[model samples]
Target: MSIEIIGLDHIQICVPIGEESIARHFYLDLLQFTEIEKPENLKKNGGFWCKAGTISVHIGVEKIEKSKSKRHPAFIVSDIEATRRYFEENNVTIKEEIPIPGVSRFSCFDPFLNRIEFLEYI
Candidate 1:
């Protein structure tokens, strides 16, 4: 028998405990993602949900520690240059990644230092 897999429903990234407001500013205000309602059962756990295009992002509350790694969630954008320009105008430090054939990509850290990547196919 073969195990069947499906598409991603959501992606959860962590923020420090009691810092949901900061996360809200980053994801909702800075990124312009639409806020979504979280179920009552999950509300007590803290954090909130938002939508970026068709992708749902769960900003979860947790104890965060500093780490130097390239771990991130990459979002495929339509215009990588415009996205990069927006990040620059917002004073977000951009980290260039190794070149991938036919792809233009870069990454930046959120308010809490979680790396998020943005890319476009050329």
Candidate 2:
């Protein structure tokens, strides 16, 4: 299937509130990716952008009337144990430990109670 598109372009995720610093700390500091700030007009829409390898993730926020941030994103890692240990060192809260049939992943919550899953794809 040789066409115009070769591979992935980017991935976008949404956050409930638009607190970008937290996102930077987790994505840039704790995890990975280089922080990319959102434009003034885009900031009002909530979130920022980051680049890792050839992929980009757009973290957006929403303003709901009630509680928000119930959604979570899953990340694929090379080593599950190593990543889990890192999370432990950071004192991150571990929510669930389940191995997917194909991929190995452990879901957890951040300081803001946002669910995230770290998995090993082998």
Candidate 3:
């Protein structure tokens, strides 16, 4: 038998315990993702679910330790420049990425230091 991998169902990003509100502010307000109800059974676990287009983001709570890593979720945006400016206007920390031919991209850190990439094809 052969195994086939399917598409991504969701991406989970963790924030410190009791910091769901902060996560909500960033994902719901700043990023403008729509909130989705969690399963009744899963409500016991802190965090919330949200989606923008086909991307579903699950913000969960945990005790986090600072780390320097390049792991992030890259989101395809309609206007990269506008997205960059929006983050700047909101005081979000933006990271400049190496130039890629035919693509405009940059990264920014959320309130919890989770890096997110925004990109648009040129």
Candidate 4:
């Protein structure tokens, strides 16, 4: 493999069609990600973009059936407990309790049942 790879540009997670508002509520309002406008040509396809640190998170639209899975995007946070408390207060189920050495973490499902992990280094 001679190809050189650069760092991540974005990670796209899919939600059902017409659920962009729900995604907005969770990603923007709850998680505090800033929404970026989708390009004009791409607007008709639905979905939107968000800024998360140096990377972009793309919420794509597709017809989907909800299911639980371990695969998820783990976001680094400054305060794990405070983030956890926010999710708890919002009624999002905190599904895991195991802590990695030197780090604190928890997993939860977004409104679309997309598993998301939030962690912080201790």
RMSD in Å for model 3 = 1.4
TM-scores of the models, in the order given: 0.94, 0.70, 0.92, 0.89
Encode model 1's per-residue lDDT on 25-81: one tens digit a residue.
Answer: 999998999999999899999999999888999999988785755666899999999
lDDT of 1 at 121: 93
Residue range with the least summed lDDT across 10 consecutive positions in model 4: 67-76
Computed on alpha carbons, the lDDT of every model, listed in order, comes to: 0.91, 0.72, 0.90, 0.89
Give the C-alpha lDDT of model 1. 0.91
Alpha carbon RMSD to native, model 2: 3.9
- Residue 82, candidate 2: Cα error in Å is 0.6
Q: What is the C-alpha RMSD of each candidate to the true structure, in Å?
A: 1.1, 3.9, 1.4, 1.6
- Poorest lDDT segment (10 consecutive residues) of candidate 2: 63-72
For residue 70, model 1's alpha carbon misses the true position, in angstroms, by 3.1
Best by TM-score: 1
Cα lDDT tens digits, model 4, 2-59, are 9878878888899999989999999999888999998999988999999977968999
Off by over 4 Å in 4: 1-5
Q: Whole-model lDDT, candidate 2?
A: 0.72
Better of 1 and 4 by TM-score: 1
Clashing pairs in 3: none
